[model samples]
Target: MSATICAFILTFSTLCGSRVVSGVLSAPTNVSLTSYNMNLVLRWGPPEGATQDLVYTTEYKTSVTNYNVGCVDIITLECDFTSLSVSMHPPIIEYGTYTGRVRAQLGSASSAWVESEQIILDRDTIIGSPRVSLLSNGAAIYVSIVDPVFVISTLRNTYAFATYSITYWNGSQKEKARHINNTQQNHVILKDLEPWTEYCVQVQINVDRNPNPGQLSETVCESTTSVEEAPWVPLMVTIFFVALAVTLVAVTVVYRKSISHFLCPKDALPQHFKENLLKPPNSTIYLDSHPPVEKWHEVQIIADTRTVEEEGPSGGSKDCLQRTA
Candidate 1:
């Protein structure tokens, strides 16, 4: 009877333990790893029938190292391992292979871990394009480069021996592109270029060990400066305009009165002089009337009759004289 009782108690306890173990939370699903511009991120989907209140924990490890906790009791669905700190492990190396895992947790119960595919940091990482800037210097262009940004370490720090590959072409003729490969200088000068013409340039990073190069930057175009003029040309033009302006101002100030008089002339004579000259003469004279007096004069008359019968020898002179007297 005691043995039967002990067997019954053991079966009851086993059933209870099985039911408690089955009640634990479900594991996360579709765990994956992605790298971009040398940044590594781990992402996962929520468990089946999981609620928003469920928290998750993330951990990552290298091939030779033990698992190290990255995120604890977090609600986010993704974790960035680029800058994650672990007390027991060193920082992530660019050439090392890494793996990540995540598990869902609810209260005191936790689900099984979901592991992600392995990734080689340097080989699998995608390199972003560098930035290019151009400046015109006479008939040449000075090219400037800015390395692409990263989440944890810089591009130069990761790839110390990296060089740049530059490709340039005339804006109108893209088929005649020119290349300058494996250049280490950040500031390079493209010499012997056509002046006053537009040219476009693109740049990418090339690592010594890595087989693939980075993506090419956005095409940047700039025109070389125009042909250089004589240094004295601008100076002469400036001086001429200044001298002309000064001479004009001086003339205006000195001859202002003459100019104003010529523009607006005043009347020559006064108002009174004009009126006197236009008036008629005031002096007037009239003719007087006179009467004539009558005057008379007397005259004597004598007549002599010829006396042929009366006068004889001297009678002709004597008779005429006596008769006249």
Candidate 2:
């Protein structure tokens, strides 16, 4: 009984010692890969009941390549592998399928490596929304597009066959939106539009290999310029004519008598006098006709010398008096 008890104690001690010697930090959990706009990130959850300060190291691998060390001694739970570079290893390729692994470390102790789900760089990545701007021309709209920026490369560089899909509509009528697809130009002009009309535009990027298109951009609105004449032109002309007619009516009402006097003078004879003058006389005076044919008769001249001498100058009066005598 004594030997058996000692053996049992030894066995218990050995088991406990082995457990304490082999203990290590807990590994990260729920390791996963997420991508956006051609940017790749590896993320994981912290170990349960973890109280000690812990650091993490990540590794990534492709099907045809060996595992390569990624972020080392990182305290954060996430790693950005989009532009991460490893020693003696090439960068992540667009067509490559990748897997990631992360483990927790505390000094010399380390947990088991946890692997993440596989992800296709080109297929699984989401494309972000593009930016749109608009300008107005005469009866036309100029659409300017800016492609979505990416962590690895530009939208056009990554997707070589990419195209811009444009949609525009009159601001007043959204149901009549028009679409222009597969346009390669970033600056596009929409013509044959109504003059001085407000238009709203939206832009999206489309890739041939991608089944889903990019997110739609924010709607931008602008107004098209007038083609021939401004809308206010006709309104101003109508107003001018109305004002002119009003002025003319006011003048005619205020100065009617003066205008009538100017057109017909007041110096003309009376209506009765005009009628009498126009009428022929009934008979002429017979005595006046005979007196015009009478002969002239000589009359004797008598000089008044006394009155002339009193009224005239002295010498001339005397000469006149002597001649008269």
Candidate 3:
């Protein structure tokens, strides 16, 4: 989105042109306020030539009161009051309505103070402008919030809060702008748009607490989707399904054996082994026979003896004895 901010400058003049006389100088003219980096600046144009040295002072007020501040006394054509100090009951540098004035000064002589109308600064007013997007491939426009809300409860800014307002119009002549409001939901999609037609849209923060609305986003304009490609949708859809079916068939043809194993497998072992596995009688296999017993026999032995006797030496022979076995 493209955007431009106006730098407002206000000036006052006591003399018509560069006419020179030995007296107080003329006030500035064509004062305009411009938006810059979320701040306001004042700029103006002055007469062509100058002879005497001049100084400047400025004042601002949220309400009617004495507001005095130092404006750059240099020969510059503009002043930035956003950072300027002031002597006032309540300062205008906040988020509220303000009115300001400026005057030219010499050593002793001074020009009349020229005052401005009500100048409102909610420098914190609108968040960065909302963003516009084209959708339906260009059939519709989308509007939504792009930044957080800028709220200054210090000033009790009581306007439409928590809502977004969208305005749209056709590019053709005599078309009245249409609007829609949404609560909290910061986005909206416009449908049933005329194909190939141009449209404009803008969005703003809606404040319900007061009549004043939040600032508007930058305006966006775009052409709707074209109708020339309407017939291609169904043709593309048919091609998609046909391609999908062909891919599935090719995969199945290449991996048929793996698919069969996964879906239907056969038994790998005999059925009898499974049946007799837990039967105790059939659980063991013996390989050896029984052993024979041994018998024993007993025997006895007999002995016989015979005896003989002999006499003394002086006597005749005595009896002799002998033993036999």
The C-alpha stretches of model 1 lying farther than 4 A from their native spots are 1-26, 86-89, 151-153, 228-325
lDDT of 1 by residue, 212-296 (tens): 6789999999998766445457669999999999999999899988878889977489889989987766644222234445698
Give lDDT tens digits, candidate 2, residues 1-325.
9999888876755654322234776678889987888877899998764544788999888888878888899999999886675455558767778999999887787888999999888778878888898867679887889988887767777789999889999998999999999999998989899988899999988887667778899999999887644545666999999999999999999999988899986878899999999886676654345555568999999976566435445546665666877
TM-score of 3: 0.43
In candidate 3, what are the lDDT values of residues 1-325, reduced to their tens digit? 1222211111122232333244555666665554332344556655344434665566665555556453646566566666554352344444466666666666676666766666556543333455555444357665555533332232224333447777788877426878787655656777667888887787776544334555677777777776434434766999999999999999999998888888997656677887677455632233224444457777666663432234434443444222211
Ranking by TM-score: 2, 1, 3
Backbone clashes (count) for model 1 = 0
Q: Quote each prediction's TM-score.
A: 0.57, 0.58, 0.43
**Alpha carbon lDDT at 239, candidate 3:** 100
In order of lDDT, best first, we have: 1, 2, 3
lDDT of each: 0.82, 0.82, 0.57
lDDT measured at residue 14 in model 3 versus the true structure, 0 to 100? 27
Candidate 3 stretches greater than 4 Å from native: 1-22, 29-55, 62-65, 85-97, 106-109, 118-129, 137-141, 147-164, 169-178, 181-184, 194-200, 204-325
Model 2 root mean square deviation, Cα atoms:
26.9
